[model samples]
Target chain A: MGLIPRTIHDIDTPAAVVDLDLVRRNIQALQTYLDGTPVHIRPHVKTHKTPQIALMQIAAGAPGVTSAKVGEAEAMVAGGVHDVLIANQVVGPAKISRLCALAQNARITVAVDDARNVQDLSAAAVAAGVTIGVVVEIEVGMKRCGVAAGAPAVTLAQTVAAAPGLDLVGLMGYEGHTVAIEDHAERAAAARGALGRVIETKALCEAAGLNIREVTGGGTNTFDITSKIDGWTELQCGTYATMDAGFRPHSGHMFESAFWILASVISRPATDRVVLDAGRKAVSFEPGGTPIIEDPSGLEIESLSEEHAKVSLTSQNPDLQPGQKVRITPWHGCTTFNLHDTVYVVQDDEVVDVWSIAGRGKFT
Target chain B: MGLIPRTIHDIDTPAAVVDLDLVRRNIQALQTYLDGTPVHIRPHVKTHKTPQIALMQIAAGAPGVTSAKVGEAEAMVAGGVHDVLIANQVVGPAKISRLCALAQNARITVAVDDARNVQDLSAAAVAAGVTIGVVVEIEVGMKRCGVAAGAPAVTLAQTVAAAPGLDLVGLMGYEGHTVAIEDHAERAAAARGALGRVIETKALCEAAGLNIREVTGGGTNTFDITSKIDGWTELQCGTYATMDAGFRPHSGHMFESAFWILASVISRPATDRVVLDAGRKAVSFEPGGTPIIEDPSGLEIESLSEEHAKVSLTSQNPDLQPGQKVRITPWHGCTTFNLHDTVYVVQDDEVVDVWSIAGRGKFT
Candidate 1:
């Protein structure tokens, strides 16, 4: 099912390219994984930052969508995703008020690690005359968020349960540190250790007279490992839907690479070196560097400027010309997706679907 | 003239905070520098990526605005900046056609280093029934774009002169490598050496019976050094309008810091460590790293994550608490502007203006 547009050469280079067939297949595979498991999937929208992809996950039987910011959650709601969870803390009156207002239209939940944040969120929800779900974030190993796993996490859960206008909704912990780990066995072991802490924290919360029902955690990297976590009820995997080249090496779950940055070779000054039109400005450098060049036999990307990428080749590939276009699969798909406003869903070579990153650039 | 909406705590954290008073003063300072010089100011719009900033530059007597992409130029045109130049190469049929269409509404010019690109641009402009201005880029040590200094550049200029429906405007070179050099004398020497090559290239073009009028180049770091180049007539400074914390140590100019990413402390688990809401997603890591913490009492940003920044204070800052908000001046102002949809232009503590980063996320 390739569209193969007649004017393929007319497309701009460094544009976010998506293979629709691959994306659909990726979605189908993730769906199959969740179907066999008891874990409910609530894919993180922060990965794609697009309502179209979020809806696709929902269509594939996701319970809801997860976002890192209240603005993104609000945008997802506006774009027709009914259930949204801010998987991070919601602080300040502006954001808390926004999150509470969003609950008026859709199901809105937020993660909390500290007592002050819960108090602020409760006051804001009370002011807005709405009750918001709050998930106690348990610190596993990431050390970025949440309180200490056992006692401190239970204490925070108690605070959330005792807070006014706040519904304590289970537990949440992000083992993001294990997402990009290379070794399968080691990654699985680390995931088990981290998720074990989350499970223990949930047990402590239950012993402290709190009813825990929905324990949500896990990313695309640890979906398999976390699927077997004893108490985890929901998987927050998002990147599996639009797999990048970096994930190909680690993911035992085979997912076709759907994301590609179409860039043109603008300069070939020396026979050994060529420059692409796309650079840090187009694709992000969030995953430490630029995309790995897919084709052009002997070339290696050396460095990136704002508008150009310097590539050195051992020998020039006969297929590559100065003006020829090539597709680049970025190291981190999530960050690259956020950098573009629109992503073209392509098959073969033609563009069949145009999807706006509805929540793109919503950092606030 | 300060809006002072309420207090610093009243506004949301992790928002793009701009001091309009500082921005105006910076603009005036740049205007003052170019008062007696023959150099034409064409402020680069890639930094702010906003039409309001471009309009302000025009109001300060800038002849035109420069953009790194065709989409940016289009946004400026829509925002009412009629004179625009795509300071980077415009390759492939889609971008060329778009550039030609943009030329139909505004004065559009682009930089070129190859003969084939010149032909492609000419063909697009001819098909669109418009004439496009072309600037022949010379190699000036950055090695990113441009042909060799003298004869090669002259030959490219000749090709541009011969091309149909294209006007050879001038010569341009970017000494990006020398921009951020910490040593003042060494930086000036490097700028002189690089601009010397550009001057020699212009003489070669003159000898080849080509009239080269405009010679444009210089970033925020090298503006002063390159301003003294003999043949250069345009200063294309972008970041000066919104000085970042990263450039403050080396700016050598009295531009006030205008941009700050306001973020709240989300976590305070340890007595010494505090985590902020802003992280890699909000600010770019290109120039060096994330924004430095601008807390009143001495504070240092140790590390950052996707959603949290682990900030360690040298001593306890009485002002900073778990829920207290702080301001972060990013390392690179340009990419940080692209990460958000709207920037709150603040005076004192009040949001005096809110401008959409209209051209943001236009990676394609």
Candidate 2:
């Protein structure tokens, strides 16, 4: 309805704005961290869900990109990504067929935990006449998905290798339980034990005559630790690119928060209380944590309604009035990005371009 | 991707399903309850956010649809809604101009708690050559957005009357503080006190020579109590059509949960644990509450990650395996509906139709 906004100030409130300079710096920082290291960065596209941003990560030294859903893989491939590793289980015939369709154009790999799921993928891939890559997801204390690390993982990988039109590509172990530990020493010990299981399981699979090429693992919190491990071929650090308030404590030393919801103070009901136009719809708080105000340091998010965020002044009240803009660092960048249709790419307060969050609502 | 799913089992996992028969029953129940009452229903579209559903509510008996944002109003008008009331403040020039533009198509009314916002609306309306309806929102126990009752509310009404290109439509008092009181008598007492404040303020505004009409209030939880209150012109009850688990505890006698996420069991790592494909991205938690498994009676949602819902066996394990469907009732329908692109309108296990949740991601 309006001209392409040339600056952040011109853009409307409750908009997802990503700093291109900061995003590039974030991409460069991960590349620098894994410079001489054997591990390569397979940036997770679920963070921004913008194929353009995923392509940016691939251009900066990443051999491929990581996706959590089949739709994301399709988007990444459509945006010109040749290689993609879906870090989660792609179950059901609908998604498996989608992956097979995508594999015809790009190198598509999915993590599998169950034998039936592997058989489903193999059948779909064979029917589509495309050889799909499969990674045995080893359980690393997350307890959400994946098979047990030792014999169970080897059995699943062997199934994938034996199935028609399927290639046993690699193994993946996500230490999701250790990613959020605040203490560095404690987190390092937890991640080492989890990754150690994956490394040992890879040896077991190799002994069983299964060829394991890529051993993918690691999140933003365990990137440094997993990179130090010997067998991890790709580090899947999602939140590192566009960091959030929850990951800032763990990854702030490496990357800065680039993704934020630019909201306008719509009401100043009390001296201590201010309401912004953005709320649970704009900024998420479940998976990651509570979002924090980055620009106005004095304001803290008290609570959020369906459409209004109630903020309170933690320090001295900053004479905020209605129509004043407030920059909020989302608690979880992935889910927050899922709420918006587009991300306004900004550089030093100037809106350079707009990229559609094409993977949003793609939870097919 | 596949043939338009003919049945619920043929539909993909992590899909939002709404039973249309239940929706029609809920709409009829609400209309029947207030058949002899003075107040008319102005259903809030924030729950479903579908213009189709909003139009359905209008067809049932609602005078107009209540929206929380300007973009929702636009979607409603596009869906054939002739009248809409945004029950929240419309601040800043960007949203003000949008409201002015929307006013030209539909009978648009917006709630205001500040003089500056009213001025902005007036200026934009004058520039756009549209007569925008303004309602002075009164703080009725909900400490989010609204002016104080009595004199302060009267003063704001007077300011709206004096503003050029604006019509002082009425007043709004949302008793959000008392909606979720578990006890009926206690909730009735609270709703009475809050509605009494709005009634007194309406009288005060009338004494100040302000022509006030259309005093709006009420939610799904407080609909019965708010309906009994005198002097309320419209009851803005949302979430009644497609109810959720969160409101079922209070409103179960009147409405059933029509909204749910049809997810597939992806993992069963333990004897007591079952993981579904739907998680935080597909179902919200903060604003609403945790989603519950409805069909499989023995399961209770333990926790949710970004893409998995971990459920625990409370009574006995149902022997759920991978690829089995589970119906999950979202804790809050409003926030959960915002997560999906389309809703599978089902009836008697058949996928009768698919409706787009048009107002989703329209948080501007």
User: Largest TM-score belongs to which candidate?
Assistant: 2
lDDT (tens digit, per residue) of candidate 2 on A143-191: 7887888998888888999999998998998898999899999999999
How close to the true structure is residue A195 of candidate 1, measured as C-alpha lDDT? 84
Residue-wise C-alpha lDDT for candidate 1, range A194-304, written one tens digit per residue: 889889888888888999989998988888889888888998888888887777677775787788777888876656667788888777775454577775445566887
Report the lDDT tens digits of candidate 2 across residue range B143-231.
88889898989988999999999999999989889999999999999999988988999989888889988899899999988988878
- Top model number, DockQ: 2
Chain B alone, TM-score, model 2: 0.97
Candidate 2, CAPRI quality class derived from DockQ: medium
Q: List TM-scores for all candidates, in order.
A: 0.94, 0.98
- Per-candidate DockQ values are 0.53, 0.69
